[model samples]
Target: MANRLECVDVGTEYCPCYLAELNECIVCSQLQGKKFCDCNWKGVCVFQEFVWAGYKAKVTRSTVFTRILKKEEINEEVVILTLKVPNKLARDLNEPGAYVFVRGYFSPSFFDTPMSVMWADEIEGIIKIAIQVTGPKTKFIASAKEGEEVYLRGPYWNGMFGQRYIKGMHNSKALVVLRGIAQAPGVIVILKLIQNKNKVIVLLDKGKVQTNFIKDYIKNSDVTLVEADLLSEEGQEVLKQFIKDKKISVIYSGGSDEQHINILEYMDKYESEAYLAVSNNNKICCGEGICGSCEIEIDGQKMRTCKVQVDIRKMLERKMSRG
Candidate 1:
């Protein structure tokens, strides 16, 4: 059997989610219709939570209308939106990998687009998101005025995997690779690493986005920044040398699956033992696991990348093999 997967909502208020009711719980084997408890969860018993909830999922996230406080057009393709939200909600979204489902106020529910939290100011009751206007959903969001309201549903934490490494490492050296619009989420990850006293080095590649929009966010921070084309020979050399020499304990790749696989290959080539974290590139039609849009089969087991934490290396390896 594949190793047990970790559910993002397992111990949160959203515990005993729809998966448990369907005997498809990611953490609790008992809830998976098994006879004995083989779960690795250390928090509240999911099976018991399910039984107590009358075999139903707990109350899920609710949609809230937030007013856009400010909007800055970075380019024709990208815009940064600062939104006014509740202080509690902002605080809840202050962690790395935080994201939310956003849509125009007049748009239908299917127009809801998952957006990464670029920055969250709890004291100010505000959050910023970089919206890349790539499709109809984002274009609609981009058209919203500064004073207009938009629908938001989250405090979602599964935007990236290997979060334990991001939260656990302290006073260590780390590397953050960012490219294109993926650079938005990298801001929060870099801030988190810096807050943990980790010395951070950021490799920035303005992939197809054509502009380094994150420079202003990290300029004043105490991080070593290097701008390069990560797909080029010089960039690959820098990445390889950094892994071979810097003794990096954790590495976060904020880009495509191809970028993650390339980094993994360098780590393997240099025999680096750094923990890897990458953006969840799965097609997430719904932030919740019920959509099945983010589902992928790995090692003969189906996983919802939206909420389940799978091995990052295994996931990238699977993609590499498929290509």
Candidate 2:
């Protein structure tokens, strides 16, 4: 059985810098016996709910402003948020497949939502994230106005596809399969790969592709976007043909659990390199691992993405070691 961790443990100490407003802790380390004073009042506990080790910051609190540059309606259910962040934050997000945790206040509750940086321009200090209206947090983000300021914590490095991984994929057939909004992390990675001159084959759902909201942004792009029901037999045949004919070297699959599993099975069959995104339903109170939420298993070892630097290349390493 895989060991798992849940935040707000009954008898464990947590980081002091844990931001209550965001419902996320700042520490990315394992929470076992760990403590820090976020208030820095000589280790005096600021909040009765959590206790931590005492540490002082020059500025006790700082908020990075995410100004909405534009909001485009992809469809009734999906929206794209274009935001301008500080230059320093943009530099941290230079890599493809990076993500940020957003803190937006809604009617009854506040949320810290993890959104993949669909696209980032370091020079322009801009990043784009696409959101599908499935949950309350997303709905709040979609309701944000162009000039509104949204609280954002990080361009978190964990669980990101590394630059070396992208550089290594030269002159090889790359196929990306995406299903629901949950698997949207592949968007920026695919865009970057295509910009690097890789002729990427994107397999997306027919309904999602046909919708003007999502399709308009993707239309007329240099990449080849193929719309199909990837779960169907014909879809499998098409995928197989592309893998065989194009000599696909790497296949990246995201979206629902079913899509991830199907692609992994397919990769195992063909012995192709498989980079699949695994979603954890654990409460991510902190995108930082300190919260102990969002822990996952790798070769029977429990690790948290927020705590460790996860790379697509490591997935292959884990698979090889298991075999």
Candidate 3:
């Protein structure tokens, strides 16, 4: 059987995006140049939206200049940026898996770097993101001074897969494992889980960034915090024990591909039925799915990781096979 694919933006106002015009719509078979409709989507029809818009894609997300409210240098390698945006934008990005493309205002569009929404305050009209200075693009962002304006294009919500579980699961227990700078995105995930009334436990490893930057964010929240080196045998034992004892219903892995694989391995070893969600980890040059840099093959289908709702199990299978 063919793998069922879901586009992150399918039912949103951003539906019938540029992909539809190119006959490459992720969820619509008819829009993919097929003669008949065979989409699994039960919401508004993407093809109908495309036709209603006169065979054109709807308006794409616009780039805007946002003022930097604050910048906190966590360490030599990491910085947290708080930007002032519109209230609506902040609210839209308050959910799990939200991310945006950011660049220094004076830089060219190619300098745009994707960063997850670490924290968002709708009432305050502000959003915070953590940037690790890994390369030129991030270095430019890191150099951005306070009170300066930065270009942002987003409200993108596919930073991670398994968003359904993140948004829908409640009154259950969840375990979030975050390492290095990957801890940035884990904040919104934890917040959303907490908002859903789920019992949340976080296993944090500062990894290469070498600082537990998120400590301040969740300190007041009702969450159990465990700091451990996830790569060590002792940490592995702790993780396995948590799975076996906590009876966690959902697990989110916020780290490198190796960490994701490790968590998946333990889940299987314990015969865990917990739902798994992991960071996208794909090269996302364009958040709009136009660049094709984020494309990956899963179950014989090519999917753009930037917008596709990938199955965590199949994604892990592909990663393990590549090793």
Candidate 4:
């Protein structure tokens, strides 16, 4: 029997396309508008999907008792949650920048949601996640009480790259832009980056109260916090000024679509590099590439975020091509 993707669009039982990079059959990817094989044998292709080495070797689906250790309202609109999971699972998630696919009950039915692991403690078997109430599901998660039981699975996506982003901190100057609850992932990313001895500047686009809530995430005294209403003209000016003054090497940003586009545009103009995290795109259902729900348009081609390793190198290539 041949291995195949779990999506319905493909007619064949096995993926006809052979991925030269992984030397594996993959129906989830295509080349030259044909579902056969890649055209180039050398060089990493931006269009190719990336499967985590651990996930490829074996798929682990174990549900452990996830207890809510702490729940606090960061602000009127945002809440932070600390959960205690299995010791082994918590330790496995020590990779600073990875997220997990969480399954929580809202109305007696289990629905899976992806949440970035903001902080984790292997010895204590504890992990923290931030929740912005965008819908009923999020609202339920935010309202979770201490000792609440939850279920979780995964340490998916580019978590392996956390060390690289952390290593990039040697550049001295780093910038992180975060807006509202949508871009909560920036909290953990910024935290790890600052720990590596970089001079960090955080541009927070939120109200004073919400900004304070965001401030709790950045305990580093060396980080400079700039508050601006990201949706206002003044906020745009602040961003431009920050971009102008810094010889920034790495930027990590998350928020609304417009916010990311602006950051991308500025990065292009300044010739700087960045990793823009997107939490709004609903297409990502399974944290694994097995499900095709996470498919979205990237440079006019459909790609899955769960499968794609998003980094500045690939993003810059796409950005430059668009210019």
Candidate 5:
């Protein structure tokens, strides 16, 4: 009934976890506690076992699909990726806009950073995530081809705020900001939301190309489409105007410090109601909670952003920091 997380330690390796594969083992590796934290697998498993025993969630066959939206010099490493968790494993995850844990290895080519899911297509029995190859773990994920099942175990994290909060937006005009490229978790969130009620989704994107993704979703629905052809002061004002109502929330998918600053000022005017999907930079070493690397304070509570997107805690901090 309650939520839980679990992971299997493949071997006797110390917790200097940095995408334990090769090549990247020496490049910006975390073998010396520079990045990774130790996890008590038994404790985690026990917690999971106590909470949800015989919990049926398995990634039977992960075929790396090449269906991705790529970018040139995609520093954010947004790789449009798709993976499938077994039907049994996915059944328990009835929550829409929730993420299940993945058990897999970091590719030898890229740096170290575990990939995370953005959303689920429960009806199709498929779980999807938009991942960015920022490090070793991600590189492996980006390179993983069709039929290659990655070793992973979990349905660790759920949707943000819960269905009640999401449903609240059902009748309002909302903003979905896309600030990430390549393989970002937001892609999952974006895809699932486009399926929302006709007016539930709002697309706030800049530029000709990026704005196109927003336009397509908006034109199809009655959702308001505000295109920031250029991220200007004018653009910020346009987005700010939409964040005022109670049913409306903003999702910042991609951006720079400048864009973040623009958002900070905008969110400050609104307070706790502002919603932001994690930036592509958020490093999630273990898709499960075993790795505390992705811990981010949301509303003063530390939560794993990879598993937990759509937060307001740090948005306040960011807003205050700018002030």
Candidate 6:
């Protein structure tokens, strides 16, 4: 009954810019529709990077979870929203902090948004997205409320947290820094880390009001909470000192892309691991792995941000090609 879109209808006239690539396909390039080999083109293949749009989910509850006050703007357009996914799909999402590439919903402007599956209560038939308003297409999403219809695709980009902590199992200490509501979706990843008793410190930068909502949740977790006082330099110093005192294990923060640079600065200062959760939707699309749009040079190789989501260690493994 929802406005669902089963993906990979590309190669059709309307979606000429998209392509597909993955390892398990049974068809050949000629049969599948590849005019040239990747080696001949841009050292990337279209066939092996395929991810399809899956289904549609209509808004069931569209209420202001966090009402905005003064400079606490939500998006550049309609960038952020909180919503729930269907139960059938929610069950498969055992990895809470992972990403689910939502494609079925089309705006007059943009067609896809890879939203983080904040947390899924399978029995309750709900999934939360702390959407940070990004572009014009997402602007429409900001305005949408419960009962409105939208499409979604795969629960891709889910394993980022799992892989991080599994590697951290041998870690001497774990430190986490979460920036805003934008990073709320990654809470699923953090929750799992805490449930497993992973020692990770959390630095949360939230508006005065949003911090209250999270007080209860942080108290219950293994995370060492560091709250940001945005109003005064003295308050902000708390964050600096927390970073100074706590020997950082791993760092994660979500905000504007430039903020990533700041988070990186702190990590670099302390000689710690760091990853940025970019929620402004600046450069993540083509979850297909074929589009090459999500490509960024981390260490030395061009890797897809859409397929990988936020994994700090993977970024460090590569040589810094750009900066």
Question: Which candidate has the highest lDDT of all?
Answer: 3
Candidate 1 wrongly placed segments (more than 4 Å): none
Query: Per-residue lDDT tens digits of candidate 5, residues 1-323?
Result: 21222112112121112223221211121321245533334432322322242333222323232222222232344444445655544553434334433434433322333344544455655555555454555555567655555544444443332233343434344456554342133444444455555254443453322423323323554545555633677766666665555565545444444555555566667763745543434445655444577665544545554444433444445545766
Residue pairs clashing, model 2 = 24-285, 28-289, 35-53, 36-52, 36-53, 37-53, 37-54, 74-213
Give the TM-score ranking, best first. 3, 1, 4, 2, 6, 5
- lDDT at position 226, candidate 1: 95
lDDT by residue for model 1 over 81-154, one digit each (tens)? Answer: 99999998999899888999999999989898999999999999999999898889999999999999999999
- Report every candidate's CA lDDT: 0.90, 0.57, 0.91, 0.59, 0.43, 0.46
Worst 10 residues of 5 by lDDT: 6-15
Model 2, 119-205: lDDT tens per residue?
677789888887877777888888898888888767564444333455466655577766666445666667656667676777776
| Span of ten consecutive residues with least summed lDDT in model 3 | 215-224
* TM-score, structure 4 vs. true: 0.72
Greater-TM-score candidate between 2 and 4: 4
TM for every model, in the order presented, reads 0.97, 0.68, 0.98, 0.72, 0.54, 0.59
Per-candidate Cα RMSD to the true structure, in Å, reads 1.3, 8.8, 1.1, 7.6, 10.3, 10.2
Reference-based lDDT, residue 247, model 4: 71
Which prediction has more favorable lDDT, 3 or 6? Answer: 3
lDDT of 6 by residue, 282-322 (tens): 35565555656766554344445544433353453332333
Segments in model 5 whose C-alpha atoms lie over 4 Å from true places: 1-78, 88-97, 100-113, 158-164, 182-198, 204-219, 244-261, 270-282, 287-290, 296-315, 318-323
Better of 2 and 5 by lDDT: 2
Off by over 4 Å in 3: none
User: Whose TM-score is greatest here?
Assistant: 3
Alpha-carbon RMSD, candidate 1: 1.3
